[model samples]
Target: MAELHEQLQQLWSTANKSFRNVAAYGKRNGVKLSPSTVKGWLGGVVPDSTTALTALVEYLETAAERESGWQRLPGGEWAALYRAAHEAKVKARQKTSAPATTPQRASSAPTLQNSTSPAQPGDIEKARRILKAFPLDASWFTSFEHQASFHRIHDSVQDPLYDGQNVLARNYKVRFLDPDLQRQSEKFHDTVNAFLHSLDHMDADGKSGYSQIPTEWRRSFRDQYESLLRKLSGQRDELMTEYGALINLFNERGIPLLPNGS
Candidate 1:
């Protein structure tokens, strides 16, 4: 069966129009839509809200009647597919984040405890939960793929027709910031901020940011972008390691540090 994204792509193909055109059609029908939202769906990011999904389904159903006369998937069927895809993605993440089981020794040997006391029974699972609940990924580079997609889409469509300054029109990078990373906190944030400050210092030939780098500088953009991502990713790894250690410390003491009833 087709996943939500695949079904959306099929609808787009059947519509036979640019995303801008489809969005315009949506506007005509009193449905607010943006090309980037469609692009996000195509990139496997589920629709942000049920209202957006319903508007998209309506737009696709009749967006290309004159050109291809192709009717899109019915609303009920599309909703079912979306729910299945969402559930599948959730299950996959849960499976990935689950803690590994430690093998048991056949011999019941008395182990001498050190002053540092090794992790207790549920510590591994608690650490896993903490890592799973952390807002940022273990690596910033992994999230960079999604950011790169946003930039590419912004570059393609942010012209005279689209108001690039409009927040709704512009597709910004997705940032998964942990609450503990805030300046108010007394931990892992400093290193993260250092990397972020490096990004702030970068000059894209007077352009607004990496996405708007001049055409001539495009050749070096990938290298520059990936280099920064690598540095940030290293910092992210360190942050995750430190966060896991902190979680373990709390877990050992029976302190509830999981994210607000997580």
Candidate 2:
């Protein structure tokens, strides 16, 4: 039992780190996990009796190759250890017996019916456009292991920026491309249109014909438009990068569709 406890302790430490890393990796893959909840797993303070030990074992097994010296644990022995631990903690077991013999009766099993509506012809195109515009690869997102680390980092730093809320927002932005980007782009266009309309209404002398505009106004407009252009350019670049990665992932996995409109 002492040996078991020692092994459990080591396993706990390994699992704590491994689970977080897995969680972080999943986040990078667009999944999000709560930092506080992840911390509980790492701290060995998980409250669920049925899951605590199982979670530790499962995480350790998943991360065994990544963790040093984890390969030394015997598989059968590990299973035995968990079983023994569970038996020691849970005392009562309810026995279930087969039904007694009785006269045969015909019965029918209920069938489930689908209620979902069929997709429209344009749905696929819309989905493709959305995917192309919003890619998932971003530094803010963490994998499973990184998720655990994120929790630790958050706890130590107490930075609200790394909290799950931001992670979730980033996720939603990445996963649903059209609404977020299109909305922003539409707002930008509206602002630019309004500015141009204002310029159109300027007094004849103030509106100096395009070729006769004062040098100062030209420079100011250039600077303002340049800044807006840069912002849009940066957003486009990020979208491309994410889309490219997503395309590669799908291609490698034998997906038939391309991420881009092509």
Candidate 3:
């Protein structure tokens, strides 16, 4: 275990990054742990992935290997350990952060089983958190592990029909929430589009153009990216189950299908 900490320090030195960078890397990869966690990990403290999902644990493990030249240590061996240790914590966090799931709460938030009520503020907040699971950042695509972690989120911010099954705005669409969420949804979609555009433009203009555009884009939107994504994806995925049940209704109706409008 002492050797593990030493190796971690070596990786930090080799990468020329501070402990803060290490912590940020873990959080960005979906673990929600900090530098302190990374420091503890070095001492065999075994950081929690904060959920039962194996992907988050895999991400942090992969990130550790990539950033530091560690040849897979005990941390990689602890998916079960981390999951067991953190499952309670995950439930605890959800219990505290999430809104009540009572009959009235479910109705207010729109449970397809019973209600299609207008989404409340709590629903919005929950969806935003879920959407962060698969953010549109280019940095997210560096590895299959990273990419897989991304797809885990059912996001429809880009095209309501992009995945049809996972749109944040469409999922939370209510008489009261729909208009505002749709508008906010556009911002999320636009950011993703801008990223794709930046990639297209990256080769032609250089990374400089990509960086400049987001500064301008980020300024246009007032909300944080993480928050918005969670709000949208959570409610969206919750609704998709209900939406799928009415495929007959969709096919019965003549939804326009046009390509460039002949």
Give the clash count for each candidate.
0, 20, 11
- Of 1 and 2, the candidate ranking higher by TM-score: 1
Q: List model 3 lDDT by residue over 96-208, tens digit each.
A: 33443434553456443223334556544444432443332312222322331111221122222222213332332222233333344434433433332222111111222
Per-candidate Cα lDDT values, in order, are 0.47, 0.37, 0.36
Which wins on lDDT, candidate 1 or candidate 3? 1
Candidate 1 lDDT over residue span 8-121, tens digit each:
778778777775565566667765455545655665655545677787777676765655887655548887987886776566546534544446778897343333554454
Poorly placed runs, candidate 3 (over 4 Å):
1-15, 48-262
Worst lDDT run of 10 residues, candidate 3, spans 200-209
What is residue 97's positional error in candidate 2, in angstroms?
28
Model 3 root-mean-square deviation? 17.4
Cα TM-score of candidate 2: 0.24
* Global Cα lDDT for candidate 3: 0.36
Q: Could you tell me which 10 consecutive residues in candidate 1 have the lowest summed lDDT?
A: 160-169
Of 1 and 2, the candidate ahead on lDDT is: 1
| Residue 254 Cα positional deviation in candidate 3, in Å, after optimal superposition | 88
Q: Using TM-score as the measure, what is the rank order of every candidate, best first?
A: 1, 2, 3
